[model samples]
Target: MGQLMGFLNIEKKNQKERDPRKRIGDWNEYREAMPEKEVREQAARCMDCGTPYCQIGTVLNKGTSGCPIHNLIPEWNDLVYRGLWREAYDRLAKTNNFPEFTSKACPAPCEGSCTAGFVSDPVSIKSIERSIIDRAFAEGWVVPKPPLRRTDKKIAVIGSGPAGMACADQLNKIGHNVTVFERSDRAGGLLMYGIPSMKIEKDVVDRRVHLLEAEGVVFKTGVDIGKDITEEEIRKDFDAVVLCTGAGKHRDVSIEGRDLEGISPAMEYLTASNRHLLYGEPLKPDFDAKGKRVIVIGGGDTGEDCVATAIRQGCKSVVQFGKHGRLPENRSESNPWPENPHVFSVDYAYEEAEELFGTDPREYYVETKKFTGDASGHVRSLLTGSFKSEAEEEKKWDADLVLIAIGFQGAEDRLFEDFGIEKDPSGRVIQADDRSYQTSSEGVFAAGDARRGATLIVWAIEEGRKAAAAVDLYLDRKLSLLQN
Candidate 1:
């Protein structure tokens, strides 16, 4: 819309990254800032289709298609193309509470469904989005605006992750007194710990949290809600409670030599590394990958994170195993337009590992059969077999450290039981109405990974906003009854 045939003229250019070899030596963000001029040109490539599928956040064929938070992609792109950065930022802020987090961390499902992508490369939406927010912050357009008035009602949010933070932010903006409880020593649960600093620096998360604090949202770190304060006490102290504890129960690979000392869960490894980086804590011997041969089991974002972390820790050698075969170079028949394309591209971790190790670290179509450890009960090597072959052909790889990055099952079970909340059949998540976000226990609501299973941060933020709206309605009804 900004320029006719702009998509054809302007080549798609993404944000540049720091040299992988140099970046792996330090714990810092990899992406370099894009220049404003280039960003505007990228924005001009937006086709501004009649039916913009990029903004239509929905699931198709079990894959997310567009922006889950329903960001106004086209409007912001046009604004950016016209050099109205402040307006673009305002438009972006209307839907996405934290573009900084999502721009850096999200997979950018919106780009996948872009109309330009069907014919040519998609608009550099992610880079443009990042630029808008970064410019806004630099220009001091982002400032704390607390509610004009206060309501008597108080709400408690149980986590400080994206969902919990979004819920608390919205509730506070609506004049409710919101207090967020985080079990960690610092705020930003997974954002602070589960993810490595290279992906999203801790200060980025802290900046937003500090702004929220200035806006009158109370964050109580180092508070374990179920243990330090009882559920009964929470219900009595606050009018409503929203649980945003993410699905953190990690999935395990039960195999031979499972009790070996060097085998650790992916979260534990990532969390330990991050804590050491941020707080200057010493890493546990098993989590430290220095001068050791590392093998990452399972393939996903978490697994890639592990690979990158190991490279940074100076691992002697590294390899990743995946049960599934490699994805096609281009989209296949099953993966059509407007759906997240199931295509393969080199990710940051792969690029970094290859740069350091002189070869790609991934081994596809491989299944771990068992582990063979040393006499000292430390893992020494692992045996793997072909994942799809009729006859299991086994191969052994020496490894001093093994990381299990399979995925998470759901939220922890004990917390829900202690709160007297009903859980679904799997007992992994709180049983809550999909639309209402209210749990079986009245006055208690659940959102994010606790209600739904483990999902994208964008989805979690959306759920948090929705849950806040639902809680607001429920509180209004309660107040009305009391008045009557």
Candidate 2:
């Protein structure tokens, strides 16, 4: 370690977030980078623990407890402390295909499992990671690294989400002629649409996609793989195919008033907002939350995003319902240290709501019974009852617009049916082997949410990297060449 006693001397310093009052006025990332000197000081807090649990990538209590991609966190942290910025970036790039995405979007299970966190605050791993990658970008250290020679092998990656992007990027590195097909107008599927610009600017995703193009990866947007292009056509053109379409079948809140005019799924609302920002497409009058009282169902990451988006769109008021009660402020005996903490902490969106509305928008222990609509068939109010209380606890809240941000079940069935792909009973693509990401059909593979159900972006990247390796081996064996 650069500073043996740095943990005791220096307090945990996190990147400063922009003032909520000012940040919510526009759609931009709210986080401000910490100064380089302070980032080094935070990095110096990494301990010399023999078993660094932060990078162990283990699952505890049915939840991820550390970096699922097995990032070399300690090595990079030490390098940062030594002022070896480039070295830190190199070590980080070796394990993570896209640190820029994870640093912003991930919940940072790695910090929860940090050994130093057992007693005191954890090392600011996410901040250090963001610093390293952002510095590299500013220095022009991140550039196209095309393979030396072409393998003359063709590969098609369906979907341009994180998993598909990671898979396509890796395959391209190994000299395979890779093409990514996206149904949307943009190359990045969820990153470009589902996530608001306030979280990750669209240009950041565009920069990486452009770099991939420079490295000889082909991206075809507005081309539906299973619709405009058939499965037979893809198989005929490419030597292999990897399905990364993601879990798009959103779980619906099929209550009595689901068909009301003012109700829509989270993705539909988010996609509309993204399109409005990127293009000149105006938000639909009904979907627009401006001056409307909004109710978001399901308190998860998607719900938080809805809250943030609604605030930015000038909603009259926003309230999110969490079916489950609030989490504990500290871990209980059942959930010990080194596990992903379920402790309560305010997210960026909730903080913004607190600043703008003078109160948190989350209401726990609330379950929706049905929705009521006005004479025009537009939703007017929501009917709800307490989760654990008596029937007398039923309440009604006025709402002009409602967004169902519950969750996703699996990938859309149209693609699977078009490809004749086999799926598990739970609707996940059935891989031939747990270790091998190959699907039932030859020369076809599955990874990310399509195979594992909806998960974190970090997990999608990890699965994509692993799937690329599997595809590389399959191609090498067929060509009688050593694997890259």
Candidate 3:
């Protein structure tokens, strides 16, 4: 709206990434910030459509169609275009609790659903978002503003990932005393350990954690619920409990030689790599990919991350196996727009692997038959077959290291069982009321991956906010009854 027909006139452009060859040498973020003027120009491309699908925040055909947190995309874009950066940040903060996290890690379904993208490229919404938040931080507009009033309610948030962090932030902002319990030494669950540093640096996560601490959120790291503390203690100390423990049970490949010494889960490998980079911990021999021929099983973001991490670790060779065929260059008829266009686009990891290996390391339509290990009980190679071949033609590739990155099944059942929470038939997520996020027990609720299985960070944040609201309402009702 600021610039008429801006979408047509201003061609879409994205923030530049550090060269794959150069970026692979360091664990820092690969993206370079776009100039302020160019970012504003990109914001101007937003059409401010009557029906902005980018903010709909709905699911279509099992894929997210827009921003799961329902960010005020057009309003902020117009504000940025008009040089009202502070206002833009304000609007962004209204929905997203952690723009810093999502802007960098989220897949950006909002851009896929942008109205301007119908004809031309989508507005560089993700880049604009990152710019706005980064500028906000630099300008000192972001600070800890603790609630002015205090409530008698005290809530315990289990897990320190995006959902748990968002839930705790919202509850603390509403005058509740919130204590976040993390099982790891660091507070950030997925953001700290699960994701590699090349994508999101640890300092960024620490900055937000420090701000939350300043806002009076107590974080208890290295404390495991149902182990270090009992369920009775949590119930007695806290007025309410919200479960945000993510679905992190990694699915495994039960193929031959699975128990080989060099085979590990992708999350385990990534976590070890992050710990090694952050705390100077030595990587275990099995987890270290140096001088090894690595093969990542399964094709997803996790697999791509494995490929990148292996490249950084000086792997001799790397290949990723995907059961599905390669995606089409463009969206197929079945995969329409606004449904998270499942077309082919090289990700940062793939780009880095291609740059280093002289070709993309992905092999699609490949099914692993078995792993062959050396006499020392370490994986030596893997046998794979093509899905397209009628005879199931087999091929073997040398693989000194194998990372299983298939994906997570869901939340660990034992955690929910410890709290007396019910799980659905799949036994993956906590069974809770859909609207209230409340579990079978009173004064207890569940949100994020604990309730919905593995999902995007945006959805986890949204669930956290909504679950916080429900918890607030529940606490207020209890208080009213007590006063009576």
Candidate 4:
């Protein structure tokens, strides 16, 4: 460790965020970068524990306890504290292919597992990570290095999302000819459309895509694998095929008046708003939340994103509904140190909503009974029941626009069926072996949400990299850098 007792001397300092009142008026990132000196001081707080659980990457109580990609958190922190900026960037890029995305989007479960967090605040791992990558880009250190020789192998990736992109990047670096097929007009599947622009600017995604292109990854946008091209064609054209299509089949709540005109899925609404912001496309009236009372169902990350999007669209009012009780202000007894801390913290969306409205927009312990619409077949109100059966209390709330932000169930079955791949009970693709990511069908492999179900973006990248290694071993009977 650069500073042996730095944890005792230095206090944790976090990056500041823009004022909610001012930030909600624009669609850019709300957080400001911390000064280099202060960030170094924050990095110096790392204790460099004997057993660093921050990079253990284990699952506990049905939730992730650390970074799934197993980032070298302590290494980068020590490097930053020692004023080795280039070394910090190189260490960060060792395991994670997209620190920019994870730095901005990941919830930082690594902090919860930090040894320092047992007493005081955890090291500002996410902030330091963002700073390293941003500085690397500014210093012209992030450049493309295309492979010197091309192998005879041709690999076709089905989706252009995080998993697909990561897999393609790894394979391309190893001299494989990789072609990514994206169904949407753009290459980034969820990163470009499902997420709101305020969280991640579209240009950041574009910049990475351009870099991938320069590295010899061929991207075919506006091409649906199952529809535009048949499974036989994919099998005949490429030596091997990897499926990285995300779990996009959203779970729906069926109830009375579900056929109302104003009700829409959260992805549809978010995609419309993103298209409008990026490509000058017109926002449909029903999808637009402007001048309407918006109610988001399902309270998680997706629901929080809906709240943020509705607030940006100039909604009159916004409320989010969750059926379970909210977490306590601090970690519970069951959630011990090194486990993921389950506590209530106001995220960006809630902060923005609280600033715009008088109170927090979250309503817990509520169950939806049915939707109530007006004479014009448009949703006007929501009928909900208390979660407590003893109370049996029913309530109603006025809503002009209703967004179903419930999480995705699994991947679509059509694509798997088209490729003759077997599926598990939950509709996830069944792998042939625990170690190898190959599917039941020969020459076909599955990764990311398609195999493990919906998960964090960090896991998706890890799965992609691992699957790429498995593909290499299957083809050449050897392993490469990705395997290690």
The estimated TM-scores of all candidates read 0.99, 0.97, 0.98, 0.97
Best-to-worst ranking by TM-score: 1, 3, 2, 4
Instruction: Give the TM-score comparing model 4 with the true structure, all chains together.
Output: 0.97
Rank candidates by lDDT, best first. 1, 3, 2, 4
The true-versus-predicted C-alpha distance at residue 215 of model 1, in Å, is: 0.7
| lDDT of the candidates, in the order given | 0.92, 0.91, 0.91, 0.90
The better-scoring model by lDDT among 1 and 2 is 1
The digit string of per-residue lDDT tens for model 1 on 259-284 reads: 89899999999999999998889999
Which residue runs does candidate 3 get wrong by more than 4 Å? none
In the order shown, the candidates' Cα RMSDs to the true structure are 1.0, 1.8, 1.1, 2.7
**Model 3 lDDT at residue 456:** 92
Candidate 2 clashes between residue pairs 3 or more apart in a chain or in different chains: none
Clashing pairs in 4: none
Question: Global lDDT for candidate 2?
Answer: 0.91
The numbered model that scores best in lDDT is: 1
Q: Say which prediction, candidate 1 or candidate 4, comes out ahead on lDDT.
A: 1
Better of 3 and 4 by lDDT: 3
Query: Can you write out model 3's per-residue Cα lDDT over 275-359, one digit (the tens) per residue?
Result: 9998899999889999999999999999999999999999999999998999999889999887889999899988988888889
